[model samples]
Target: METTFDAADFHQTKLQNQLIQQLAAVEAQSNSTWATQQGQNSTRLAIALNLI
Candidate 1:
């Protein structure tokens, strides 16, 4: 019984680690996309101001 419990606990911990890693990856991707969008927007603004 103890062995079975240990196995289950280990499996649960492994799954939790995987979920955390996946979440971190998603957050990083979102941040990169937001940064890119901000850069593009500022570039457009700069061009518009120069034209004016």
Candidate 2:
């Protein structure tokens, strides 16, 4: 037998895609910020230890 899909399923799929995209954007931004902070901290530590 053939099955039929509903509007609700389509809406749910769209919402899921939107949520996934938003999450990916936020995660990328967070990773960028974390990397920047880590680099800054490393520089400060090196300066303090006269390594550079």
Candidate 3:
């Protein structure tokens, strides 16, 4: 029982670490995309206002 519990705990910890790393990567990508979109939106808004 002790050995089984230890193995399971180790595996769970590893999986948690992997999930955390993946989530961090996704957050970074999302932030980068958002920044790019905001810049485009500002440029578009400026052009539209100028046309008006």
Candidate 4:
């Protein structure tokens, strides 16, 4: 015998996948922004220390 799948279950799964993808994208953007800020800070510190 074969089992049947429900439409609601499929829809819920799709929605969860979409949310996961969106969260991953947001995380990547945040990390990129943080790295950029760190680089800028390092540069400023170097200039202040007269090491650049």
Best by TM-score: 1
Error of 1 at 10 (Å): 0.5
Give the CA lDDT, 0 to 100, for residue 32 in model 3.
Answer: 99
Native-structure RMSD, model 1: 3.0
Q: Clash totals for all models, in order?
A: 0, 0, 0, 0
In the range 1-52, model 3's lDDT, one tens digit per residue, is: 3445677798999999999999999999999999999999999999999999
Note the Cα lDDT for every prediction shown: 0.95, 0.95, 0.95, 0.95
For candidate 3, which ten residues in a row score worst on lDDT? 1-10
TM-scores of the models, in the order given: 0.87, 0.77, 0.70, 0.83
Identify the runs in model 3 with alpha carbons over 4 angstroms from their true place: 1-5, 50-52
Score candidate 3 by lDDT.
0.95
Q: Which stretches of candidate 2 lie over 4 Å from their true place?
A: none
Question: What tens digits encode model 1's per-residue C-alpha lDDT throughout 9-52?
Answer: 98999999999999999999999999999999999999999999
Clashes of 4: 0
For candidate 4, the 10 contiguous residues with the lowest summed lDDT are: 1-10
For model 2, how big is the CA root-mean-square deviation?
2.4
Clashing pairs in 3: none
lDDT, candidate 4, 1-52, per-residue tens: 7577789889999999999999999999999999999999999998999964
